[model samples]
Target: MFHHILVPTDGSPLSGMAIEKSVALAKSLGARITFLTAVEPFHIWTDNANQLAYTREEYERISKESAGGYLDSAVAAAEAAGVAVGRVQVETDEPYRAIIDAAVERGCDLVAMASHGRRGVAALVIGSETQKVLTHSAIPVLVYR
Candidate 1:
């Protein structure tokens, strides 16, 4: 049984599904849920085109806001399910690492995440974070596609 579940999301529809599935699993096991969001920093550009985009500070502000927006829904869902929930946001380009680190830091026993279920060439082209987590993480990962 999972006592603490770590749910990593990016606000995608698939991520939303993972959140719901995690909630149901948590509810069944009477486990608390911790939601972690990894937001990438504004990209560094070598050309003058970078001037058109927001500054680093601006980017962080907007990113945090958007990440919060994503986390809020999960919080609401957990509350509706009558489960205790916690939220964590980390700014990192590598979300897969962030997810694993959060699990260790939060003492979460399981990571429930959504998989796009990409196949072969497409899967290689668009790398799978879920696959990376499964490959690199010592903790258990339950992927809901």
Candidate 2:
């Protein structure tokens, strides 16, 4: 019964699977989907020790390129499934925050995303974005592993 579904992708194979699943679900429900890619800004090393420079142009270009690559596949899949689709690329270091915000901001009914399926030490050291989204998001999150 989801009218609008929000799908977040990191361009991983697991994410691709989730995208396909979301597209299929949307098609079956006659719902639209908003494909989202949260890009982390690039850090630049500066020669001067005092301050770091923020490369806004580079960040925009790189982020868009990354988003394009991810969104293209999602968009194509959704279109092929005969589902309406929207795409968004947000620049945020905290991907989970961005994902939750987009879902709420866009009035999406469901958030479907992929879990990297990390375990033990690796998961603890590098916290899962999917887990963070689950922890902080107010809406429902459907996770695919």
Candidate 3:
């Protein structure tokens, strides 16, 4: 019953699998899929001084290009599966916030993503972005491991 589906990817193998799943599900349900990627802002600093630059146009351009490649792959996969798809990318320091915002802004009803399946020390070391999205998103999230 999903009209708009948001599929967030990091270009990882696990995220690729999630994209496949999302595409298949969308095809079955006759839903439109939105493939999204969040590029973290580039940080530039010196040894003595620290400064944050969020308005680097070149950085944003590169990020958009990188995200476009990933989104292109997702679109191809969905098209091959006979599913309608679109894409969106945003540059932000907070990836989770960017993803959730994009989903809401695009009017997506569901978010389908992959769990890296990190556990134990690894999980602790690198916290789960999927978990953060689940915690913060008001929309439904379906995680594929």
Per-prediction tally of clashes: 0, 0, 0
Task: Mark the 10 consecutive residues where model 1 has the least summed lDDT.
Answer: 117-126
My TM-score estimates for the predictions, one after another, are 0.85, 0.81, 0.79
Q: How accurate is candidate 3 locally (lDDT)?
A: 0.74
lDDT of candidate 2 at residue 50, scale 0 to 100: 19
lDDT of 2 by residue, 34-92 (tens): 99887655546534221133255754565567667888889999999899999988776
lDDT of 2 at 115: 76
Question: Residue-wise lDDT of candidate 1 within 1-145, one digit each (tens)?
Answer: 7899999877777778889999999999999999988776565662323223567677567667878887899999999999999999887657789889999999999999888422211111013777898899999999887
Candidates ranked by lDDT: 1, 2, 3
Least lDDT summed over 10 consecutive residues: which range in candidate 2? 117-126
What lDDT score belongs to each candidate, Candidate 1 first? 0.78, 0.76, 0.74
- Which candidate do you rate higher for TM-score, 1 or 2? 1
Q: Which stretches of candidate 1 lie over 4 Å from their true place?
A: 46-53, 117-127
Off by over 4 Å in 2: 45-60, 117-127
In angstroms, the error of model 1 at 100 is 0.6
Q: Provide the RMSD of all predictions against the true structure, rounded to 1 decimal.
A: 5.3, 6.0, 6.0
Candidate topping TM-score? 1
100 Cα displacement, candidate 2 (Å):
0.6
